[model samples]
Target: MRVNQAALDVIPEARPPGRARPLAALRHRNYRLYWTGQCISVIGTWMQSVAQAWLVLELTDSAFLLGLVGAAQFAPILLFSLIGGVIADRVPKQRLIILTQSLMMVLALILGILVVTKTVRYEHVVVLAFLMGSLNAVDMPARQSFIIELVGKDDLMNGIALHASLFNAARVVGPALAGLLIARFGLAVCFLINAASYVPVVVQLLRIRLREPRPATGGAVWRDIAGGLRYIR
Candidate 1:
């Protein structure tokens, strides 16, 4: 049987709604690359988290110190996350993410080297944990906002849900793997692995073809901040 070319072209475009389909956002080539790279990097981030917590326990043998370390690593989120969203609105999110990810890589390497050299102290861990947390405070907003540029408004919700799924999945696998690595090797290896994981994400960010959206204007920084505050209120 012969088919009409025009009919064939029309049929593929008329996809049925409410049908179970592969997440449409993943269809974008750039987004697929970005998502894969992020997944790998997030898993490494979780692994490093587990390793760091374990290292604190090993060094101080105190649960209080471990709690302190975790708090130090997360406190900035409470303090700076709103400011971070403002920065993300003002900057190129992709470039900002690349910068923050690179910083994280360097911090991971520093911790890894200190541990491997047997020169790492509890204070060093605390300082590095705070540094990492500060970087994350900035990174999270930029990374979250970058997704809109990749897939646009049409797929934003699907992308976010998929991204959350990947994050939680990593949360599970990363800590389990870290536990194994810490038992067989050492905490330093986990940090080193985390550093290596960032490499692919950086490379992927560089390769992604995105037209960085222009920053909003017509308002002072304080005005914009106040506007956001009022909106939330």
Candidate 2:
């Protein structure tokens, strides 16, 4: 028996030829879900970031203090990201991300509530900024590593490139939207919206089922760090 020529040609045409290579990572179902959630979550994150800066300036009226808020928000990443990487290696990335993201959502809600009730203080903002930064220090490394689990090794580079594109795109849109939201509704709404955005991420993360094996746990924390550094070198 011979196969029909028309039936054979359908296989090649099954996928649209115009599909862009950059979006190849999105072919994986887990990556599609993860990327969609990140799209919403990162935009919300950037919106909160812009709103936070504006709120600090409004509360303190000091350029020095505004700079301080920026420093507080990122200082943890500078100080503890190596520790975060070690932690990410030692535990499951999915659970770590869910924990960090949930905590961040709570922090955003707390800040929103403070602002809405007219009880917000510059001190509150500073402390919350530091806490959010601490969470990100852990969340970032796990997130970066988890792309491999989502898309696997074949599309790993594509997955990373797509993730960077999402971050950059969010950087542009989120701040502009924040400015508009602040001008019209006020800063509290930005924080509240950001908190709401995390809902989809947590829900999607819960839905993701990874086939990859969990990373093996190692001995001393310092030893793991040194081994990682040696491998990098």
Candidate 3:
């Protein structure tokens, strides 16, 4: 039978509403690459977190110091996540994520070398924790928002849910893996593994293709920050 090819070409490429498939977000190529990379990287991140705590306790033997390390690691997020959100809005999310991930990889490598070389001190752990936290302040917002670009709004919910699932799963798996590695090899291995994990994420992020970011609206930085705060409120 003869067909109207021109009419066929005009049909929109979208899933019908109420007919979303299982694992809907994984259908997109960009999201698949992102998810794969994240699966490895987040597990490594958790491993480093576990190793860091263990190493801190081993070095200082002070619960207060450990608590302080935890605070230093999270305080930046409390203070700068808002700023990170603003930056994420202004910059290309993909490139920003790559930069942040690369920085984190370097931090992990530094800590690993210090531990391996027997030169690590409690002071080094505290400072690295703070630096990692600061980087996270920038990375989290960009990484979270990047999912929408990977899967588009249609699968946004699915993409976010999948990411949450990945994080929780890693939390369970990574700590257990870290414990085993520490017992078998030493703490340095966990940090080194974490550093290696970032390589995949950076590579995957580089492979992702997205359109150029729109020009940021002109305004004072403080004014933008205030506007973001108000919007959140």
**What's the number of clashes in each of the models?**
0, 0, 0
TM-score of each: 0.90, 0.89, 0.92
Every candidate's lDDT:
0.84, 0.88, 0.89
- Return the TM-score for candidate 2, rounded to 2 decimals: 0.89
lDDT of 1 at 72: 93
- What candidate 2 gets wrong by more than 4 Å, as runs, is 1-20, 229-233
Worst 10 residues of 3 by lDDT: 4-13
Q: Which model is ahead, 2 or 3, in terms of lDDT?
A: 3
Report the C-alpha lDDT of model 3 over 161-185, residue by residue, as the tens digit.
9999999999999999999999999
* Cα displacement (Å) at residue 213, model 2: 4.0
- Estimate, for each residue in 195-216, the C-alpha lDDT of model 1 and write its tens digit: 9999999998887776535766
Cα error of candidate 3 at position 98, Å: 0.5
Name the lDDT value of residue 141 in candidate 3. 92
Which residue pairs show collisions in model 3? none
The alpha-carbon RMSD values of the candidates against the true structure, listed in the order shown, are: 5.6, 6.2, 4.5
Which lDDT tens digits does candidate 2 get at residues 108-136?
99999999999999999999999999999
Point out where model 3 deviates above 4 Å: 1-13
